[model samples]
Target: MKRKSSKVLWIDAPDIKARIEHLVEKASIDWVHTERIACVRSGNSSARAYARIWGLNQVWQQVLDVPSYYCIEVLSEKFDHLPEHHKDEILLHELAHIPRTFSGALTPHTRRGKGSFHDKLKQMIAAYARSFR
Candidate 1:
């Protein structure tokens, strides 16, 4: 008998931008415009968390410097492993960071220096990630 290889569902840029619009509208923020979205292969040297943020920064600068660009860069390996529902959750969580970035209120994921909001944000993100699985 032959074994079947698992195929991961990928989220495209327009879908991501649409989701961002939904989240932003729900959050009562002004509209965000995106210029483009593209995926580039990542090297092993970078941390996944940091790389994700770096991808967001790339969008931020490319679209507009001042406006926060909602983006995600899943590890190619992990991207291949993620199920569809989990992808939705992650996209939403990453979009949640946009308002903070745009407003200049963004902070590191660390818990010690910040208050409950940041921690709560992380918790909610984790919850979202878990809820789909």
Candidate 2:
């Protein structure tokens, strides 16, 4: 069944839950339901800086007492600028780590399909950025 899109007002204007849901759908997976998921700007990040460490094309999290999973944080900048499809791709990348999944998480130090999955996701972010610049 197709999931209906919902706008998350707590987050920035561009951070519609629909985009995240779209990503989940594209990956042929489902997002774990949580009551207080939030998408916000990185505390010390800005657009002027490179996106790899912190920018519109990146995201990070601070895990708390929840042992199985932590807070899933996406940069407001990166959350706003990606194309629809690529946004979905990024969502898939992040969602791949949801509980049980074979692909699991992509490690930077390891290679996949002749190239690192990390590099490929970076390429996706870069490509998404280049489309605007």
Q: Pick the candidate with the highest lDDT.
A: 1
- Regions of candidate 1 where Cα sits further than 4 Å from its true position: 1-12, 23-51, 55-70, 99-105, 111-113, 117-119, 122-133
Give one digit per residue, the lDDT tens place, for model 1 in 1-133. Answer: 7545554344454544565454444444442333432323333433444225333454445667654333455555554457765655555455444443353233445547656545555655565545447
Let me know the TM-score candidate 1 reaches against the reference structure.
Answer: 0.43
**Which digits, one per residue and each the tens of the lDDT, describe model 2 over residues 1-133?**
8545644233332354455444444433443442223333343334342122111111322223332222345555555476766555556455433333222223343544655656545654454445456
TM-score of each: 0.43, 0.39
Model 2 earns a TM-score of 0.39
